[model samples]
Target: MIYLQLFIVFFQIGLFSIGGGLAAIPLIQEQIVDTHAWLSISEFTDLITIAQMTPGPIAINSATFIGIRLAGFAGAVVATLAFITPSVILVMTLAYIYNRHKQLDAVQALLNSLKPAIVAFIASAGISILQTALVDTSQLPGAPFDYVALVLFILAFICLRKTKFDPILIMLSTGLVGGMIYLIL
Candidate 1:
């Protein structure tokens, strides 16, 4: 029953969450924090840090970690399958439709319209996560926002906006700095 429940819940999340992993954070936060009671916000925060540091997409890493935590190896397998099913279906279906509709301007235009909406959704998710991470509201006093975090966030943004270097390096450096700051302060 737990396995089935895990699959259904994650399937719903994966099916509805558009614009990829960071965009999925809001939903992940809701389910993990509010619905299941499997993990706290702090746990989710730690899970995210682990997910980002390892290989593969953030969403997949999270599914595996949280799933296993919830129900062991079976849970991990269940969550991973559930999480990816929707995307696999979507991409395959869209590819078929796109090939058939390639000659149609209206079909292309619709995709273009969706692009902006996806960007907006992703931006909203990023802001929500940032607020949770960088804010020191009364709700989560223990995880107060550190000054080092703010500095790194700004510096990384500057580097990204100015330099042509690969983004992964910047993320790794920031993650390391964040870990050090989190531990020391």
Candidate 2:
């Protein structure tokens, strides 16, 4: 029963999450954390961090993690297959349609219209992650904000926007710095 539910939930996510893996974060959060009550917000945030740090798409990584947490190895397989199935079908269909109508004005217009919506989805995911990453005001009484995380975020943003450094290198460096800081403090 739980496996069935996981399949349906991830199937929906894969079907409707239009802008790739990162864009699926908001939907996955809603379903896994809010709807199913499977994982807490902090757990979801940590899942995202792990997903981002590893190979492959964030959506697949998240599905595997959540499934394992819920029901172990078999659950992970089911969830991953469910998450990818819709994308496989959709991509094949879209590829055929796109190839056939590459020069059609309507096709071009439809593609253009989708770009903004994709951007919106990505932005929504970013905001959701941001809320989790930053200090939660409703935390313990008089708890201080996560200044270190904030500083790292700011530096990362600047590095991404201003420099030509590779993002993976930046992430690794920040992870090292963050770990050291936590150890020292």
Candidate 3:
């Protein structure tokens, strides 16, 4: 029953998660954390971090990790397949429609509308993650936030916006700096 439920939940996530994996974060959080209680908020946040750091799509990585934690290897397979199936079908359908009506004004208008929705989804996900990362609610009433993390976040933002440095290099440098800070503190 749990296996079936996992598949159905992930299938729905895949089917309606327009604009790709990042867009699916809110849905995933809703189902896995709020609805089913499969993972706590902090665990979900950690999952997102690990998913981003690892290879492949964030959705697939999350599905695999949660599935394996819940059941086993077979569960991982089921969740992954369920998460990807809708995307595969939709891509094929959209490809055909787009090829046939590539020049239609309505199709172009619809595509244009989707851009803002995609941006909204991405922004929501970013804010969610940022809140979790910068706020340490477990601390005392007066010390509920991680100032160092906020500083690092601002520095990273500035580096990415102001410098033409490679993103990978920035991430690596930040990781090193964060590790050193951890050691010092």
lDDT of each candidate versus the true structure? 0.88, 0.92, 0.90
**Which candidate would rank higher by TM-score, 1 or 3?**
1
Off by over 4 Å in 3: 1-87, 140-143
lDDT of 3 by residue, 131-155 (tens): 8888876675765677778888899
lDDT of 1 by residue, 1-185 (tens): 98998899889889988998988878988887799888989899999999999999998889999899999999999999999999999899999999998889999899899999999999999998777657767666475665676788889999999998789999999999888887877
Candidates' TM-scores?
0.54, 0.53, 0.54
Indicate whether candidate 1 or candidate 2 has the larger lDDT: 2
lDDT of 3 at 1: 85
> Residues 1-185, candidate 2, lDDT per residue (tens digit)?
99999999999998888888999999999999999899999999999999999999988999999999898998899899999999799789999989999899999999999999999999999988876777676676765678888899899999999999999999999899999998999
Q: Model 3 scores what on Cα lDDT?
A: 0.90
Clashing pairs in 1: none
> Candidate 1 has what TM-score?
0.54
